[model samples]
Target: MKNAFVFLATGFEEIETLGTVDLLRRGGIHVTMVSIMDTCEVIGTHNISVNADSLFKDVDFSLADALIIPGGIPGSNHLNDYVPLKELILQKEKEGVILAAICAGPMVLGGLGLLNGKKATCFPFFEPTMTGATPTGNGVEQDGNIITCKGPGFVFDFGLLIVRNLRGEETVNEVAAAVLAPGY
Candidate 1:
């Protein structure tokens, strides 16, 4: 099975992270929970804790067809500052890999020069940093291989998006039917 690497770091939004994991798994995509920290346990922004499958230094993110980043303060900053991870992000995007970030995460991608001329969206807090991002009130935005979403409230939409991308329209429709959610 082709893997989708969902990068999880400390201070991640629980719902945004979990929502994507659940939604994409339902669509039959192999979702791997990768830790960006030294340990496998990551604490969420809401004070919940989730365990990761592996440490950031241990995996080859390049094996992933797509890269996903959930949003949080300073966590976004942490992802942007990690040299190795940043290299992986740029390298993957350069190779036409699907890159996704949500909420403050778009700022992380923008910091890496991914959102310069692309139509992207993020949590309202980072709008000033986006420079020229197009706002999508609906939550999720796909700009080429860069997929973004607003925040936790939009996690479901964002996950459905990953489903649509990895599994195609037919699978999205089927999962949407199973999920009983309007947006798919």
Candidate 2:
């Protein structure tokens, strides 16, 4: 099975994180929720608390096929500021692993220069932060190994896209049908 790590820092967007996890798991990916904070329980921006499957330092990411970042206020900033996470992201990029982010989460990629010369999309206000990237302002945009989405409204599309990238269109179709998602 393909393995994926979803980072859960404090103040993460509940819908984007959990929705993606749900979809990926349904598509047969082994999804691991990783907490970057010192504790396993991380609170979302809306005050929802979720216990991560593992701490950031406790998991081996060598098998990861994808690294997912969900966007929310201070959560995105925390992810961008975490040195270890940033380093891992860079390493993953060098290995050609898929890097996916939603909303402000793409800011982390933007700040790391990973978006350079790539077409990406993020929450409108963060367009400037995506240095060297062409902001498409679409609900979902995929440029090679990187996948980005606009915001909460597009979480399902974002998740389905990631599933497609990691698995295949057939798996995406199955998952989408199971979920009864429109326009699959």
Candidate 3:
């Protein structure tokens, strides 16, 4: 089974974070929610609190097939400010592991220079933060091992794209159908 890790921080977008996780799980992907905060309980931007599967320091993300980041106010900033998570993200990119982000979360990747020469998209207002990437205003953009999208509205597409990349088209179709989503 494909293993994926989603990083959680305070103020993360509730829909973006949970929706992606739910879809990934439905696709039969093993997903671990890693909390960047000191505790496994994370508070979302909309005041929803979720208990993560593990703390960031307690997990070995090196074995993950993909790393996901959800975006929101200070959540993206929190993830960006955390030096260790930034380091691990860079390392994962260097290893060519799939990296996915939505909304402002892509700014974290862009800030780390991972989006250089890649086609990426983010919250429209945050395009300037995408550094060297060609900003596509699409709902989702998958450039090589990197996947980026605009916001919570595209969470399903983001999650489904991750499913498609880690599993296959057949699995994606099955999962989408099972979820009664727009089937491909």
Each prediction's total of clashing residue pairs, residues at least 3 apart in sequence or on different chains, is 0, 0, 0
| Model 3: CA > 4 A from native | none
Residues 1-184 of candidate 3 have per-residue lDDT tens digits of 8899999999999899999999899889999999999999999999999999999999987688999989998999999899999999888888888999999999999999999999999999999989999998999999999999999988878999999999989988888888777635
- lDDT for model 3, please: 0.92
Query: Across residues 1-184, which tens digit of lDDT does each residue of candidate 1 receive?
Result: 5578888777887788888888888988888888888899988877889998888788866568788888887667777677877888889998888888888888778777778877788888787666556666547889898899988887877888888888898988888889887754
TM-score of each: 0.93, 0.98, 0.97
For model 3 the TM-score comes to 0.97
lDDT winner, 1 or 3? 3
RMSD of model 2, in Å? Answer: 0.6
Ranking by TM-score: 2, 3, 1
Question: Which is superior by TM-score, 1 or 3?
Answer: 3
Error of 1 at 145 (Å): 0.7
- Candidates' lDDT values, in order? 0.81, 0.95, 0.92
lDDT of 2 by residue, 106-165 (tens): 999999999999999999998888888999999999999999999989988999999999
Report residue 158 deviation for candidate 1 (angstroms): 0.9
